[model samples]
Target: MSTETPTPFAARPGFVADEATGVAAHYGNPLSEQRDLAAGRALVEAGHRAVITVTGPDRLSWLDSLTSQSLKGLAPGQSSETLLLDPSGRVEHAAAVLDDGVTTWLIVEATEAEAFAQWLDRMRFLLRVEVAERPDVAVVGAFAGLQGVEALAPNGLPLVWEDGWGEVAEGGVAYADEPSHPARDWTYRETLVSRDALAELASSPVPAAGLLALEALRIAAWRPRLALEVDERSIPHELDWLRSAVHLDKGCYRGQETVAKVHNLGHPPRRLVMLHLDGSDNVLPAHGDTVSIAGTVAEAGDEGAGAPAREVGQVTSAAVHYELGPIALAVVKRSTPVDAGLVVDAQDTAVAAAQETIVPPSAGAAAGVPRMPRLGAVRR
Candidate 1:
């Protein structure tokens, strides 16, 4: 659990609790709040996220050798993201990274902070680095260039982390082929502030958007969250995360080999897609809900039915967007046809799902080496 201080915004009028995230779900009108947030007229209390600080001269270099992104040369006030992967290249943890010359700040999900900090500390053998979790530090999120937020930073630097999600970072690669990806218009930022600053803002006139509003925007932008998008078998290629988080040409890190092999020789087993859910029933599919090709389930229920509907994928995140009635991000088998009409099983109702490709089925095999004929097989 998070060791962070409780958010003061919860006491505000119209606040509804989102226990899973430990933040206010909404301040009554989630749609209005989302509009305000996207227009840069509101700020969000992000106490559900935690801050971990790594200080000392060796911080950058030491971090560089452990994560997927190249970090040794990060400039002060620079923003980037890196993933800590298991030996076989499965995502274990993710953090939004920022450097302030004297310290490197890692903003991660609150639930993962303690373990993440402990793991980092254990890895610091003889390195001149000291890792510490800052429970007193809180996070505030808003659209980039929103005024007044930066002033709340305890230090002059603000320790702000501008998200690099939509654009491909240096040495990175992109799998999404849209002329303009939804994420390209996302200009989100997170600023670290002291607990006193959070209370000050809660009492201020600055408008507040809740987690519900933020989540709607995130879903519309097709941004993947670690807690939602990642699973035991997840890889960067599956979610098109290489666009921002993975530096394809970076020096060796823990999972570098698997990353290289998958990009060069094999395709990811699954791919991410956006689902425009049927909102006629006004029902939203929850995370882990079944997703399958339309008609499969209904057909299976007939008197002398065929095989039951096989789950092609599962919904990772879902939300009701102001402009887009209902939308979700799901990870499905890569071989599931891109043009196939899909459905989501929500509350025993078959909700039609229109598929929008985020990561294409042909998302890997970057090296593109020619295939050789199989033994005793005739060549076409």
Candidate 2:
């Protein structure tokens, strides 16, 4: 689903480019490599990520006004994320942000880098901020990359933006309150490197992983990547993204009205769920598969007396976890019951799934009352 072509990996052997990112999809055995990486034995190629830099005193304050997160006080080396929403609050872009004193670094999808930089350039107004895309800079990811990030740092800005989705950030809300969240060990970090640096790593003694390995860990942790989870109708709440990428109390931003209205008064139209797939057929549902209850929808003038299967969700991403077997992350209607039995349509086959709720249906109704019209006064 990503438009990013993989960065050049000329020094790596046995890796093959089979995805849109053009990076290796696997180095022969993806499952074994998944285990190695999960056990902290490997690093994955993040050729799909792109880096952008915003320099000037106005960088932090200017970016704070344009995105969802509050970044006025973001200190150097602090990692965060921000979402650009359309006027309707649908997520248009997501950026992994890091401040390095003199500059603000934006780590975004390679496919989105140019456009994102251009957009920021146009938004700079009379501000001193200077936005630039760094095509010379590529990315590499590892769970323990932070400890060695200094060694991997490039000359100008050795940006190392840690992934903070594992826990709730300050001033954010958590919709998923599971005591032992499956992704508790999801400690991932990305390092910016020169093209030559990535090539050197490709030749290093350390083992390299493909896209599949990264995806398995991410899906198992219930993480939502914009390239995979976002559709035209996507909003931050549906993916439980408010837990990290959003600042609920942040002052007026482009889509703040919609964000507040959805959080305070209305429930998100849909919610995120983890699906334990019944891999009896050893088949995985591809992205964009329709999800329905485990039965068939009744059609008009239908002869069947029982209700027909109705689509309640869509499989956003699917993978085979080293521990969880086959699993998927899905976006379902909020009203879909938490205990509902689900089936994912994999073209010709319908794979069964057990639902694990992420964002509950009653998620935003904290006031515990029916919403009334704003213009009219309360009835006496």
lDDT of 2: 0.83
Clashing pairs in 1: none
In order, candidate lDDTs are 0.88, 0.83
Clashes of 2: 6
Residue 184 lDDT, candidate 1, scale 0-100: 74
TM-score winner: 1
| Segments in model 1 whose C-alpha atoms lie over 4 Å from true places | 1-6, 151-155, 299-306, 374-380
| Number of the top lDDT candidate | 1
lDDT of 1: 0.88
Q: Return the TM-score for each candidate structure.
A: 0.95, 0.91
Name the 10 consecutive residues with the lowest summed lDDT in model 2: 146-155
- Residues 58-170, candidate 2, lDDT per residue (tens digit)? 99988889899999889888899999998899998999998878888898987778888898899989999899998777777878632333333433556777888888989
